[model samples]
Target: MSTPTSTTAWVHKTTIKPTEKFIETLQKQDLPLPTLGPKDVLVRLHAASFNYRDILIPRDQYPFPVNWPLVPMSDGAGEIVAVGPQVKSFAAGDNVMTVFNQEHQAGRHSIVSATSGLGGALHGVLREYAVFPEYGVMKSPKGWTHEQAATLPCAAVTAWNALKDIKAGQSVLVQGTGGVSLFALQFAKAMGAFVVATTSSKAKEEQVKALGADVVINYNETPKWGEVAKKASPRGEGIDVVVEIGGTATLQESFRAVRMEGTIAIIGYRAGPTKDGEKEPGWGEILGSICQMRAIFVGSRAIAEEMVSAIEVAGLKPVVDPKTWTFDEAPQALDWFEQGRHVGKVVIKI
Candidate 1:
């Protein structure tokens, strides 16, 4: 392919209203191509997926600060249209997906890697072309669509980190039907573990069951569904790992569900649909639960590659929401996702 000098992009812009309130929006524009470094590659993005953080960054509502007026959307897949001289892992026409964190090539998470995330610390892939260091991307799974590969970077990688060290016959508990939870259910089952899933919708409960969940509980009908999950585990000991995403609202119940000294992977902050909001329990309650709670901010590039290999081996398919949007409809798609209208990932085809 000929080298391109310009590309179409959707920039995340934050404007201050006269009332001192902030408005978040995506502005479409023809932008100059990214500057290529000796070890960088230029990707022509085909598809990208949305994450909850994408909704917060533009609004300046994300807890972590971000660069404004940047090309947004971290999870993306495409072909390498060009590469710098030192780029070796990939070449022109190679299919690849963006790494969630540019500096996190392998091993454990660190302060540098944690903050070097694409779309947050670096320019992301919501454009016709983008550039990244050679370590910032990897080849997509064989025969996977750009949309399908796009869904893995954030939600799937986070789920994979949450279930690290999972052994066969272990008990894993997932909350709700969000992207991370559903992926956790599928991954845990693939690892030969028993999965206990919780959801408010009867429709979603059936879907979760079909994903090979050993037990499915309705949190609305059973507010204390955590105890139920505990009892449903092997030998009724409790969950070995809890993919905790509900934040303060669901923390208490998660404590109840995890086994003694089990791991609670704090993944997301979406609250449950409840009147007057849910209560956040005190540390005493957490101490009583005796569970280990730690935040896993997605995963490194090495982790992502490992996940793709496992996915190919298991033939696992990610669940993308049926309702999708065109590239021009990005802002509208974010709004729909913010309103919690979809059960799985809401993607945009570029």
Candidate 2:
């Protein structure tokens, strides 16, 4: 491993408190390198991706509770430089990635203990170097880049967890052109499931179709895009699974598109109210609309491992866009992400 640098990262200060509006400036730090414990491994982060939850948590709309002045990202990928004495699963040359639940390393949700996520409660990987417990990291598949591996932990695993039991030839409905939604499209297609993806712009209709979506609906052209989604399938049967990302603006339509006894994974709310003055809908109304199969947050590490295996077996490739900034340009990257024009994942190279 190379010598640890004194100027390893750019840290962001608490722009907004826990219950305030969004703030976008990052405060740089000249602090010493982080020290590792006996059971820890230090990772030099190469790239980190943005999630809708990352954008909303700082804005104080997300339900996941967290502290201020925290590094705000849940997904990252990097290489291990140093390992504690007790560590045996990895070495200095190993390329590993972090998981969403630090304690839930490799099992179902019930088997794992509840620990705070990296970018959730504790300091996150927006920094250049982060120290993680040996259990929280996993070995990346051979030949995958740090950026591709970094995109998997949260959004990719969530899609895998939602569709793990789905049989081949089943149908899934993915909403919009976001990170999680795109992962749902790719993974569902790899699983041999018929996919129907939605977009507000007709120009993107061919984009989703190119990604193996059997049907594409322009929500802007047809306010009831769900009706169009239903007609795309055989016998007018509704979709067997719906990856519901639109919280209030399109939740009822998701309900209308789902088949009886089908599943809907409520991963995120990317297109809801942004400002404080706008009127927000009620939860009862939202839940009342999604009167379908069980709804879940994300999957466990076991599910994540299953996803990795599937991706490797099927040669699945993550739909990553491009890096617009480096570690020093974090504030700009976050600002660009808030605008919501990018198609795939927006990453920061550290």
Instruction: Find the candidate with the highest lDDT and give its number.
Output: 1
Which stretches of candidate 1 lie above 4 Å from their native place? 15-24, 272-278
The positional error of residue 56 in candidate 2, measured at the CA in angstroms, is 1.1
Model 2 lDDT, full chain set: 0.76
Over 1-350, each residue of candidate 1 has an lDDT whose tens digit, in order, gives 57888899888665323333222446788888758889999898999998888866765656655776778879999999888998878889999998898888888878788888888877788888887788888999999999999999999999998887999999999988888998999999999999999998898888888889999999999998888999999979899999998887888788889999899999877884333765676778888888888898898888988999999999999989999888888877777787786877888999
Per-residue lDDT of model 2, residues 145-258, tens digit only: 998888888888888887877778888999888888888899888888988888978767877888998888888788777767777755577788888887766666777787
* Global lDDT of model 1: 0.85
Best by TM-score: 1
Off by over 4 Å in 2: 1-7, 15-24, 31-34, 106-115, 273-293
